[model samples]
Structures are given as C-alpha cells and as structure tokens.
Target: MTASTPSELIARSRRLGADPRNTNYAGGNTSAKGTGIDPVTGEPVELLWVKGSGGDLGTLTEAGLAVLRLDRVRALVDVYPGVQREDEMVAAFDYCLHGKGGAAPSIDTAMHALVDAAHVDHMHPDSGIAIATAADGEELTSRIFAGKVVWVPWRRPGFQLGLDIAEIKRQNPQAIGCILGGHGITAWGETSEEAEANSLWIIHTAEAYIGEHGRSDPFGGVRAGYEALPQAERRAKAAALAPTIRGLASTDKPMVGHFTDSDDVLEFLAGEKAADLAALGTSCPDHFLRTKVKPMLLDLPAGASVDASIARLTELHEQYRADYRAYYDAHADASSPAMRGADPLIVLIPGVGMFSYGANKQTARVAGEFYVNAIHVMRGAEALSTYTPISDAEKLRIEYWALEDAKLQRMPKPKSHQGRIALVTGAASGIGKAIATRLAAEGACVVVADLDLEKAQSAAAELGNADVAIGVAANVADADAVQAALDATLLAFGGIDLVVNNAGLSLSKPLLETTEQDWDLQHDVMAKGSFFVAKAAARALIAQGMGGDIVYISSKNSVFAGPNNIAYSATKADQAHQVRLLAVELGEHGVRVNGINPDGVVRGSGIFASGWGANRAATYGVKEEDLGQFYANRTILKREVVPENVADAVYVLTGPELSRTTGLHVPVDSGVAAAFLR
Candidate 1:
C-alpha cells in the first residue's frame, strides 16, 4: 500500500459503509492508508478522513468527509491552542493532507488528530449522559461499559474538549473511545468505517441492556390516551377547567391525553408514595437549569369539583416552590449570583403526565428525554427498593458549574425597565401576588390587578412602602377593561418599566367534560389578557431608549397536560411561545420579556384552593391537609412555596440583579424544578 495506490484503503472504506449491521446513527470515522507503513504491507501511504458533521453514521460517504494529513494534524494539536484566528486553526493542518471539498472536518477533529489511532468516531448516545449524571452514574457506566470504555465528566466543547480527549487517549492507547460523562462518546478503529461501525455496535449494545432491564409501562402503545373521546365530553371538561392551564398549553387542540393506567406512572402518581417518586427529574442537571427540577402533582379525589382540582394543583405547586426555596437556600453559595424567576424545572401531575420547559429546543429536549429515562429508572428503583437522587455535592456542582453559571449571566439584560415601574396581574394571591409584591419591594412601582379587586387593593396596600403601589380592577380578558387598567397604571406610575402578566384562574375537569365557554373564558384571561397587558406595556417601555421587562406567570402544567386540566396547561404552553416571540420582536426595542413560573402558591391567600396537592391527595386517598406536608417532605429540600419566595424572584428579575437576563423563565419551585422525578 504505497502512496501511489491509495485506492485500496479507500475501496475498503466504501465496503465498510455497506455493512448491514450498521443501522445506528451512533456513527464513527476512521482514516488509515498506511501511516508508518503496516509491518506486512511495508508502504508509506497515510489516510486521514474524519466523519462529517450532521449525517448519520449508518450511511456516510467520501462526500461526508474531511481528509487531512495524519501526522501533520497531530502536530498542529500540540500548539494550536495559542492560535487566535480562524485561518490559524484551519491552516495549522498540512495542505497536502486534504481529502475532499465542502465537508468540514468533524468538530472533534483536533482530538482525533492527536490520538495514536488512524481512525476515530464520536457519538452522543442517549444512555451515556443518562447514566453519567445520575446518582449512580459511575456504577451504571462501569456496569454497562465494563472494561470497554473510559469516562470524563461534563466540560465545554471545542479546543478544551478536544484537548481532554487527547489526554485520555494518551493514557489508554488501546481504549476504543472515552465515555465523556454527561456529554458523549469518542471511539476509534483502524479504518474510518471500522471506527464508525464500532461506535454503533457499542451504543446499541448498551441501549439493548437498558431496554431489557429498565422499567416497562402498561400504557405503552397509545400516544395520547382517550384522545378519541366524545367532543361534548372534552368541551365540557375543558370549559369547566380551562382557566387553570391558561398560557401553559394549547387548549385549542381538540383532544388532549393523560397517563392514567401505566402501573409505572400510576405508582409514581400514587398519592401515598412521595419518597419513591419525589426524587424524579430529567436524568441530568442541565435539564434543571433548562426545564426546572420538579413538577406540580395534581391528584384530586373522585368527586372533586373543577375549582377544587385547581386549588389542589395550586397548593401542590406552592409546596413545591417552598421546597425549592429551601433547597436553594441550603445549597446556594451566598456569594453566587442570585437565581431569578419562579418557574419550577419540571412539573409532574400524577395521573395526567409531566411537562418540561426550557429556553430552547435542545434544553427542552434534554428535559423531556431526561424525564422519560428518569421515569424508567425511578420505576425500576421502586421495584428494587427506594430511589435516591445524586448527592447534593454532585448536583450542586453541575447546577452551579462555572460554565452554566456563566451562561446564566450571558443572557441579554433589559435596560429601559431598570429601576422603574412594574405591574403584576392577578396580584391578589398565589404566584401572581408574590411577583407583584416582590417587584414593589425591588424599587419598582407596582400595580396589582385582579378580578378580586378588594384583594388586589389589599395586596397593593401591603406592597406600597418601597415603591408606589396601586390596586386596579379589570377583567384581563376584556380589551376595554385591560386598556383602562393600563391607562390607570400609566396615570399613577408615570410609565411602565416591568409588566408581569401573572394573573390566573384555576379549574380542573377532564378534557371530555370541558366546556367551550369555559375554555374561552380561561384563554381570555390567562392568554389574551396577558397579551394585551404586555402589548400595552411594550409600547410604553419601547418608547424610551432603555429596555423594559415583561414577565408572564406560566405553570408547570404547560409542559405536560395533566389529568383534568388540559385547558390550563395548553394556555401556559402558549405563554412560553409568547415569550420566545416577544424576545425576537422586542429585542430591537430593548424590551426584555420573560416568565416566572411558580408551581403552587396556595398558602398566602388561599384563593386558589384547587391545585396539584389537593387533587393528588384525593386520588391517593390522603386528606387535603396532608398534601402540603407530603409534597414538601418529599422534595429534595423538603421545603414549600411561599408568597415571599416568589416575591423575591420578582425582586431579582425586575432590578439590576439580572440586568443581562431576558427571555428566561425562573422556576422558584425549589429543586422540584430540578429534581429527577417529575
């Protein structure tokens, strides 16, 4: 195999791609013509092909390739870190080592370049991160990978990532690939195709192990259970309870589903079992920063009214929030930049399903996938005994890792709204009220608006010290009323700096029994009302050169439409998109918009009696009184949500504390938003 006949190794690469066993997207790359001359072949031909970006390993070709000189690429890695320019990084490689055009080398190219192998492949297998971030990550990895791989903890990608990989290869010259804990994989072979094929083989083998050993579900086949139910029933239930899930889900979707029969789901949903299910969340900590830790559990008794269910979910959410605060206070380094918002990481509504939210699809995907895997693991752990979360130290390390903390700070902050006015809707009680009160305390004049005008007035009176506070009465769903309310705010406060569309109502009925009128009513208040308020505020804030802030009170219910509250969840989901759109549109005007989702704010005003806790209590045969303690006890910190806690979040986002923050949702549900079980 001389440099004159490179076709032999290239033909072998093609044959390797044609193999039938390589069905996994878990791909690999290899390059080997004859680096130092095979002892038997006795020629000096070198091959250096990298797997292309964005293609499945199952069907890669020379086109999905970036070829470079093997020895030269390796030499460049040794000194490339000091290079500053893009041209420098690209030019560090030997020009004669080129393979094909239009295919950028793998992002992992630098790592492979430094390794002693002729071929390399990398993949982000589902099971790898799942196993790596969990409490028993090492045990799981060792058991599954056995003697086949090495592991590295989560680290930023790019040059540093590549350098770390190179170091691993240096130590384990014969290792196939290193399992980057909380990240992905890096594998290699003698040939490009063999490296790719080996990667697929290794991951699928592990996938098979997880599939056979993990918990199985009873509600396995159907995507949306009971989606085919009668329209009348669905409408009736929707109308009866749409208010609860407003802005968190899409109530317009005709058929919403719930998870009722899965033994695995039901057991977790079971009211009596908090310890068994309390620790559940996405498999990784980043999911918490994205989706929140815990969810609001909704379990109402058989005969509860829609209002009752709403009240219970609210209560449970509040409890979760309190638990989250305790966790934060316990684990938070006082010197650390304070976390903003009231959104819980994940929301779990027993008997319904789970919901996970994040700033981007990747984050949401991480949350959703983590929940799915966590559910499987939690169920299995229950079968074995009790399940425990990763140690606090491990969780805290990931949660406050320098990189993640830096990301938290990198978000674009709003300017106009800084040190100005704020209006909190539905400020009479629960999370809405908390936000309103907190903003006022944070030096922003606040207008507390709610249907319960008197309660709003009382809340305003209570918050009037640090900043001007006014009570306003208006139907958020009514354009005229909302307009009047806005006018009143402008009249009293001068101009709006921050708008918190936190007003909400709660109702809980099965989709089959939801009513059209009820659905419209809920949407009008939570979704449409929120829009008008924000639009009104946006106009005023954008008028000034400084940016402003708008926050909506969305719920965990948005992530997963829980049982009996599809309408509410749908509306909340819509709110999330609203923030995304607002961020895009308002970015130019310097208006910072975001959300603060509080799980349950039941204790303060007790106005929302029907929420997650009360409902779940009924379902599990526990008394409503027991729900709060039950939820609080089970969460990571065993804390409960308080008006003060959510209020503190309002203070954080509405002030200089989070100047660079925009389009972010802060989950104040303690670690519930961050917990594994959701």
Candidate 2:
C-alpha cells in the first residue's frame, strides 16, 4: 500500500468508523526509506525502514517507515529502539535517526527491522483496548499491568511510543508488548515467531469482551434504533423527501434513515407521529466529520397546527445558524473550513440527529460526526451538569473572518522606527528645521541633524526643551559620519523613530553643464543620505512595533521643469517614488508615511541671504524683495505660500489626524493643481 501522511491515515481510519477518542490516542507518526550515510563505512548504504508510529502493521505503508543504512544499523544496537528507558528513547531515536534517509527510524522499527529482528509485528494489545473502552480504564490498566504490561496512556505517537514501550520491556523482559488503551496494541520481536506469540497473548486477553458482548457486529442492530418504521412506507416517504432536501444540500444522494432506539424516538414515530419523528438522530457524535456535533431536537406539539410546527422548527434552525456562526468565528484562526453564508452544517430533529443534509458524502460524513460528537459531549457534560467546548464567538470569527489572510498580504509589516525617535537631517533650517521643530513640539524627542554643528546647536537651543532636542553635526554624504550619526541617535534616545529626509544641498546647472562629479555630489547628499536614514530607521522602527514614519521633503522641481536644475529635478522625482515603495512595504504594522513638495521658501533660515534672494528675484524682473509675492500670484491660488504654510503641511502629514493616509504627496504650491489637471 502507498504510505500516506499521518493526516491522511487518520482520515482513512475515521472513514472506517474510528472513534475520535480512539484515534486521538492512536498516535501521530510518519515513515520513509532510502540510502543514507553509513557510520562504520563512512559511505552510503541501503536499508528497509519503518517508523515507531505505525504499530497498526496491517494498514502501515512504506510511507510510514524510515530507513537507516545497514552498516549503521548494527553500530546503533545500543542506541536503537527497545534498548533505552522511556524517557531516553526519544533522545536515542533523535541521535540514531538524525538525517537518516531523511527520516527518523521508528524506535520499534530498529529491533523489528534489524536487531531482535524479523518481519516485525507490533500492536497495542487487546488488554489495553478493553481497558481503555471501560470507564475505569486508567485505574484498571495500572492495576493489571503494574510491572508486566507496558501501559502508555494518550500521548503523541512515533518516537515517544517506541521509547516508552522499550522502557517497559526493559523492566519486564518477558512482557509481550505495551498496552495502550483507547489506542491499539503493538507486538514485535525477532523472527515472526516471537512477534506472533505476543500478538496472540494480547488477543487472548481481549477475548473476554468478544466472548461476552461481541456479535456479528459490535454496533449490531443497534439498528433496533430504526426498526419501528414500515420499511416500504418510510422508503417511499424518504424518496419523496429527497428532492426537497437535496435542493438545500450540497450532496446529490441524501442518505435518509430513521431512529427508534430511545423512548423519545419510538413515541414520536408511532401513530400520527410526524411531530415526534422529527426529533430522532444519531447515537453519538462524529462531528470532526459532522458539523456542529449535534442536530436540532425538534418535537412539535401533538395538537399544534402544521404552520405553527413549521414556524417553530424554522425559528429553532435560525437560532442554530446564529449560534453556529458565532461559535465558528471565535476559535478558528486561519485554519478552519469555508462556509456558505448562514447555512448550518448539520440540522438535527429530535429523532433525526445524524440525518443532516450535505453537498457530498464527505460533507454528510462531516455533518454526521459533528452532530454525533456534540451529542456525546453535550449529553456527557450535562450528565455532569457542565457546558464547555470552544466558545460560539470564537467559532463565528473563524467562520466569518475575512482578514486573517488578506490583511497580511495587503499591508506591509510596520517597522520599529515607527514612533519612537525622530531625526531631521539638515534640520538647522528650511524643511528639515521645520520638521524637527514640529516633531519636538508634538511629543517626539527630536534630533536636529545638520552639517553645520553650530547652526544645529543654535536651532536645538532655540527649541529650549533641550531634553527633547539633540544637535548633531555630520555631512550625511560621508559614510563614516552617517554611521556615527546613527550610533549617536540610538545612543542618545535608546532608539530612533521618524526620519525626515530633509537635509539637502542645492546645486543648479543646465543638463549640458551638469558634470558627473557635480551630479554625484548632489545625489550623494540628497538621494544617498535619504536612503541611509531610511534603512536605519526601518530597523529601529520594526523592533519597537511603534511603527515610525519617514517623510521626505522632496521638491516640486521633482516634477515640473525648472530652469537650470536638471540633477535636482530628476533626483527629487526619484526620491518621491522611493517613498511610495517604502510605504507599500511598511504599512502593515501601522506605519504611515508621506512626502511634501514645497515650491519656494524664501523666508526660511536655510535660504541664502543675498545670492539666493537676488538670483530668484532676477527671474521675473522683480527685485529680491518681491520674489515671494511674484511667484505666489503666478499660480492658480494667486496667494503667497509661506514657510509657515509649508511647515503646517508637514505637521499635518505627520500627525495622528492623517494616520490613514500614506504614500501621498501633498504639494504646498499655492494651487498648482491646475497644471496637473490640464
């Protein structure tokens, strides 16, 4: 048989009517076989493999086995399965199985496949099965197997199973195999002879339950549960009901059946019993396969009107749908199954718990199990007056949740520079200074970064709250200084947050006159420095989860043509886009980022005193004095845009007020929207 994954095997077993209680304790394991490194030969060798988890030898497949090199196997006698105490088994398996044929050999597999060897036979003895099926399984198993039987309770299977069994065997050399109640038994030894004997011993022990209670079938007319119905009449009725039922179900064949075991089922199905018959269902839950684990307990009154009965049943179903939606949404993370809107997975009438509708056998099976399991748990719990399982809210969140997967994909992870420390390079004046001053004014401890230490210090001094301001001098164009600036920022404030890419150098030259050296120089300070600050801030912000923001004070020259400023314009445009990509990648963790394009700030401290004012003023035949107003009236708004106006723009972009907006460019250019619109 093709070996399968543990999940597949468990699924198949459930199809064979395996009980969850039995399956959960069956064990979890996987196996594989191939050539692997041989410890003794220092080369590869071939071997047959089996893992410890597949004690159910009949259904075990090659996929459930693990291989070790033949030469390596002999050398591992002392370290293989059956040689160590239970606690030591896992360690030994890990050591011997380390990278062996790409899997760890099952502990028992070692002795069965090689050592005490033979075609190994291993099983959880019948003593365990009987004990586990009994109410006092734990106490009884302990008492009977004190020293002779290796008794292991519910635990993860595979290496652990082998290790525990080995320990038990070590204590009782004559013991056949461990008895795992609820799970099955495993019997293994050299030569099929020893293995067969062990198997017989376990079977003989369980022969008692078989002798007293076993019939042709363990779940025998247990069908007396459905015997009362007139076969011919009910079959016709069910066939007739199929069309209506199938319309609402996903399945083509609706497996219609009845119940008559309980007093309630019998009384309801007898006489003019549509009212009573509606309540019957399965005896136990298989909800892992079924849906909600239990179905509706519908019992219409004998004298009630048909319309009233239908209305009441509909109401009950609606309640079930609401409650199921709530429960599914609550516990499911990203691992639950998909659901159609408002459709209940299973519907139980008082006598028809397992007769729920579905789209397919798998779905029907799922619904059946869901209802059955629920009945077991609920009835059992109620017997003890307890009500507990996963909560409804949890189930609904799982059932209705849309964000678990999409949110992660759509939002970039928030970085740590997100909200802790603020850095404003070139902050002594202009946009940089505005950003630094603004950040300081609004709760952020600010670092006034500038190439001019004196100016930076003066600016910090002006802020007055020195505790929140730090003046640092360094040409960001210098790599060493940039690193030191980062180190200083981190050292001073413990970490960094907002990084305003404000520091910049302006060099204007026509495209033909823009030399490589001149281009590199401007690019180094503006583009390169901005990239460095962003990289540093990204690291710091991600660590904090505070999600810091990065704002670039790119120029409008980044867009429209400007006289004799080719290098600045191209780089500015590129810088604006770079901010866009960063925002895309960092928005997930709550980081908001944006850029500001300021046209002209003649009144800013960063502007040159004589040459800057004169040169710009010469363009429109206006004196240095009327330069700001001349440009103000040139745009659609016809109003002079001030340094303070630009400052306010930056403040707004970085504040909580604009938390949802990012990767946006707000131009502080006295109504330049017309140019773009045109």
Candidate 3:
C-alpha cells in the first residue's frame, strides 16, 4: 500500500487540487517519502518530495517538488529551536537538499516531513476550514470524526509545530489526520490513494455535519432594502463606478481589477451579516494574502444610485487606508517587513457585488477567487456555530513572515504595461491584431474590438484568456457602439489606459471613378470611426481621472499623393488631423494622442484581402503579388513594411519611452522619402 512513487504523488496532488472543494489555487502542498538514488553518492537515500512554494498543486510536476534528504531533515529536530525561530528553519532547508534540489521548499515543509506517514496531504478545503474556524472547532472536530481526527490548536507552522503533530500521531496511532485550528486540514496514510481518500472523507464528513446541524440561515436573513439589483442594472452600476474605484485603488500604484457578481457573492452581500463578517476578515492565510486582511464594504444600502455610491466610496476608502495604517502600527514590529500599500484588495458593494485589485489582471482575478473562498468559509463557519478566525496579531505575523517576504522579493519586477488596459479596434487580423498581441505580451490587458465578434474572440483568445484579453464587438462608426465598447472595457479591467483607433477600410479609386458609396464607406469605418472611438475613449479617460494614450493607425498615403487612392487617402488624412486635434484637446487631461503612418502592410491585412490589394496593383499596372516589392523598392531603405512594423511603431508611440512625446506621427515606412511628414 506504500505509494512513494513521485509520479503517483503528483497524480494524487493534481486530483485533489483540481477540485476547488479539495483546496484553492496554490493553497496547499502534497508530499511523499521514498528512497531515491542520490546523484552524487549513487546510493539509495530516503528522500522527501514535496510541492514547492507558490505553485498550484493542480499543475504540479516533479520539477515543482523540493527534494530533501530525510536524514538531514530528521537530524534538524535534535537542534530544533522554539517556534519564535521558525523562519530560520526555512533557510536551513537549503542545507537539507538531497542534491541540487527540485524547487524551493514551502513554509509547510516541516509539517509534511515530521508527520508519521509515507504520504501526506494538506489542503484548505472550504468544508474543513468551516469546522476549523468555528468558535468550538476543537469540540466539533472531536464530534465530527469521533476521535479519528484530532484537533490541533493554532500554532504558526514551523519545525516545532511539526514536532507537535508527530507527537500527536505517536500518542494516537488510530488517528488518520488533524484539523489545523483556524487554518486547514492535514491527512496522512501509507498509500497515496488512502491519503487522498482520508482527505476527502474529512472534507465530506465536515460538510455533512455542518449541513445537517448548521443553522438554516448562516448569515442571518437578508437586510431590508438591501436586495440585489437586477442583473443588467447591477452591471451598469459596476461599469459606472469601476473607474472611480480603480483610480482610488491605484493611489499607491496602478492596479488592474476584476468584478464578480456570482450568485453566491450577490446572496452574501445582501445578507444582514455580510458587512460585520467581512470586517472580521478571512480565516485562512491563503485567503487573506490575496484578499487583504479585510475587505472594504460600502456603507450605502443596496441598489443605491451609482452617483451616490461613487460619492460615498471616496470617504470609505480614506477611512480604510487610515485603519490599515493603524493596524500595521499596532502589530508590526521593527523586524517586520515594511508595510505593503494600504489599498483594499477586495471592495464589497451590496447590490453591485465584489471588486478585486492587484498588480495585473490575472492577479486581480485570482484575488477575487480567493475572496469567494473566504466567503464560503464564513458561510460554513457561521452555519455551524460562529465564524471565528485567528487573531489580527497572528495574521500580521504571518503576513510579514520573513519567508513570505523573501518570496515577494524573489518575484520578477513588473512588466512595462502590467496594469494597463489597451483597446485595439479591428484587432481580428493584420496590423491591428499585431498591435493587440504586442501590447498583451508587454503585460497589458487587451480588448480586441472588431466588427466580427467571432474573429475578434479568436484573436483575443490567442493573446490569452479573459483575464488578459477579451473580444469586444464594435462598429466604431456607430457612436453608441463605440460607447458600449468603452463601457465594456471599464467592466472588464476597471478602466481603459490605451486606445488604438485602428479600425479601417480602404477603397482604391481615381477621383472620377470614386462613387459616393465608396467615399462614404471608407470614411465611415476609418475617419468617422476613429473620431467616434477617440471621443468615447476620451470620456472614459477623463472619468477615470487617469492619463492615458490614444493612438491612430493612419497611413503613408495620408501625406504622400497616390493615384487611385482618392477615397482611402482622404479618410486617412482625416484620421491624421484628428490625432493632432485630439492631442491638443486631451493634453489638459494628461491624455497623449499620437499616430503612426505605415508605408504598407498588405500581408495578412483584412483591408488588402478585401479587394484593395488587386485594385491598387491594377491601378499601378503591376501584379498584386509584386505590388509590395514595388512599394519596398520605392522606399529609401528598400525594406518591405509588414504588420509587425506597424505594431512596433504603435508600441513606440504608446510606450513609456515616448510618454512625454505626443501630437506626433511616427513613420514606419522604411524611409519612404515622399511619405515623410514635413
């Protein structure tokens, strides 16, 4: 029954981590004790393979495990210092490495190592914590498992805690696991399958106990006049307030945001007890690390007007920061790490649901997920008895733990556009798609707005999931559609930072051959469309009170006279002038307006694919296949400009390097002498 294979451990860990009911993302660790041939000694040595710090167990691999020598790990117990020196134990783990090691060991390393078992599973399942955080968690644990599961009081995890658990195991040979008070559940067995089954049994048994014995209304009845708003109204209100909230949250630094209005969140927010419970903060360390100590709850009743809520949020935010500072001052010792920013990671509005913020979109989204886990913990705990988490002093000690601070220091610096949200029109293909992809790569949340919803969605998916990029259907020529896109942008990532007006269509025709329809069509999608997008984006930028960038992807033909491009040339010229005009207008609001005039981007271009390439080639008396080469030869550099070239130019215009430069049109024409702006 001994399942010491590293592969089996990984499979078992993934199985548990995959289910949110088993644990949260990156919330728990799994380990196996086995014999392995040491690389240097070439002799079988007892090895401990445990999941390392800061990786999701569901995505666990052999490389994610920290391999340590069992002999060295056991020997440390003889020299064991008290709990006060627990952090030093984390550093000592490096010396215990079997060889080069697999990954950095987590703080819970000792907990897994000293436990008497061939296999171990530690998880933060909502059910387990629901019982663990109850006011009488020890009694509940005794009753729930009938002595099979023991109750361990809250002790900061380290070497001593591991010793305590090992002693507990020695005293109670029949015990399968222990419920970590105010923390989570830990189970062990000789086999991996048995360990997993034990973990599940503990979780299900706790859940059933709570479900049957729990109060019907865990959070009490819904508050009068605080019912949730209708779905559409709720979303609209969230959209309206997102920018204001984002701006406030970014007081210390810019942050991206995520909004969730799940039924669970809505129901919890509407409950009479939600505000008080949220004020008490979360029970699990995994929950608070991302969600912060306590969420900021709006004072206004549910369904309040958006304006009223907005006015009230400012005052509440001020109070939240002041309280956060006071908490740090009270508990943080001189040895503690510097206080992190005082902004609330989670903001709760009764009717509108929850808003979560972090350095990037994925982080923000995950923070929201953690808060939901906290909500579930509260529900279960309250249903069983009372939801009682660990003390603030304990939470602060863990939050400022030396090992955790070191992990933060080890993280890579933020990317250039980490907190930025960029909207690129006509982003389904060609130059627009390239710009969106480039922005996303540099860590910007992207909106691939296009006329074709399906193609836009595909392009956005290629960039990343909803956390990184989203497809938005928009016809920029329609002012309402432009506004809707901007509103969607606000809801998607809290607000917009970069606007790329790249939606366009080209019609190649001589003045005499140009019909009214051709002229109107080109102008509607390019010149007028650019204006609409800029106007809508400007409004959002001003509302958010965040300075941003507006870029127009014009064309070389706008400046250089080209035959058979009457309609296309006129439309592009219109877009070029609009850039200059908007630059002067938006400068007061700190919004920079710029343009890029690319020589040609025929390859993969939707505009060129839709008959424009052949039309322009025919007008020039050249085959469509040779048109690009002819254009390249005409340039001083004789380099063909592709979609990526345009993308690069766009990046330069909107990037931090050119932060101070605006009202300028950069050329991506490979030195097209005639196309150069005078």
Top candidate on lDDT is 3
Which lDDT tens digits does candidate 1 get at residues 434-458?
6775665544567888887898889
Error of 3 at 154 (Å): 1.0
Candidate 2 structure quality by residue, lDDT tens digits, 111-184: 34342333234433323344443445555445554544566664433344444655666667766655554345
Candidate 1: how many backbone clashes?
A: 108
**Model 1, 434: alpha-carbon shift in Å?**
38
What's the true lDDT of residue 169 in model 1?
A: 75
Q: Please provide the root mean square deviation of candidate 3 (C-alpha atoms, Å).
A: 1.5
The segments of candidate 3 whose C-alpha lies over 4 angstroms from its true place after superposition are 1-4
Q: Write the per-residue lDDT of candidate 3 for residues 1-678, one digit (tens) a residue.
A: 233488999999999999998899899999999988878879788889999988889999988999898889988888778777777888899999876748898888898899889999999999999888999999999988999999999987778878888889889899999999999999999988899999999999998988898988898999987778898888888888888899888888888999999988988988999889999999788988898889999978876888899889999999999999999999999899999899999999898889999988889898999889888899999998899999999899888887788888989997788889999999999999999999999889999999999999999999988999999899988998988888899888988999999999887888998899999988999998998898888877887777999999998888999988889998899999998999999999999999999987878898889898999889888999998897888889898889998888877778789889989998898898888788
Lowest lDDT 10-mer window, candidate 1?
250-259
Instruction: Please state the error at residue 665 of candidate 3 in Å.
Output: 0.6
Rank order (by lDDT, best first): 3, 1, 2
Distance from true position, residue 515, model 3, in Å? Answer: 2.3
Better of 2 and 3 by TM-score: 3
